[model samples]
Target: MASIAEVKAQIEQAKQSSQQAMRAVQMLNNQLDQAIQQITAASQGTQHPKVQQSLVALQQAKQKASEVQASIAGGVRSATEYAAQL
Candidate 1:
């Protein structure tokens, strides 16, 4: 088993990693929003099924990204709280 200081260090590292992931997820979501907007604008007059499929995929990706962001935020919070306890 690891010592108390080692455990604390591990928790702190994990918390930092989680925070980094959260930032990345935020950036990804922002980019996806821009892509969706562009896709919508480009497909304004087109009845192509491909466009529809693309939009659907983008929406799905946005949803998944949101979920990931939430998960990462929760992890970061949990890790920080745990490390504080130590």
Candidate 2:
């Protein structure tokens, strides 16, 4: 049987974790946007094939990161709700 204090602590931890995940997601999104802009600029001129491939890879990574972020956000929300119930 968990005490009220323990439950509260868990809730606070979950909140902190969620906030961290959100920040990470935001950073990744910004990086992805920058990478896209760079790729676009390179494409306009004499761009190397390797650069284009790298950009594609970056885009894919960004997509994956977004998915992970969504999962984290969902977990955070669920934890919050559970904590409130406690």
Candidate 3:
């Protein structure tokens, strides 16, 4: 059985790891945005079906990434609250 302090430390570590993963997801989302922009620019006012689909896919991915980040943040907040109680 772990002491309160040890359990708190473990929770904190998990929180940090989750935060790091959130950051990485954010970075990937940024890159996806860049790709979308580049594709739009390359299209130069042409309505390409494939390009439109690609853009939509990227946008969806960004939205999902944002949700993931929010979820992770919530988890971290919960962990912090639990640690405070400890």
Name the best candidate (by lDDT): 3
TM-scores, each model vs. reference: 0.83, 0.81, 0.95
Q: Quick one: RMSD of model 1?
A: 1.6
Candidate 3: residue 78 lDDT (0-100): 92
User: What lDDT would candidate 1 get against the real structure?
Assistant: 0.87
Q: Write the per-residue lDDT of candidate 3 for residues 10-84, one digit (tens) a residue.
A: 998998899899889989988998999999999978898998899899999999999998999999999999899
Clashes of 1: 0
Per-model tally of clashing residue pairs: 0, 0, 0
Error of 1 at 56 (Å): 1.1
lDDT of 1 at 14: 87
Candidate 1 regions exceeding 4 Å error are none
Q: List the residue pairs that clash in candidate 1.
A: none
Native-to-model Cα distance after best TM-score fit, residue 7 in candidate 2, in Å? 1.1
Q: Identify the superior model by lDDT, candidate 2 or candidate 3.
A: 3
> How much is 39 displaced in model 3, in angstroms?
0.5
Name the weakest run of 10 consecutive residues (lDDT summed) in model 2.
38-47
User: Which sections of candidate 2 miss by over 4 Å?
Assistant: 46-48
Candidate 1 residue 1 C-alpha distance from true site, Å: 3.1
| Residue-by-residue lDDT tens digits, candidate 1, 1-86 | 99889998888888788888888988988998999899889889888999899989988998998999888888878877887787
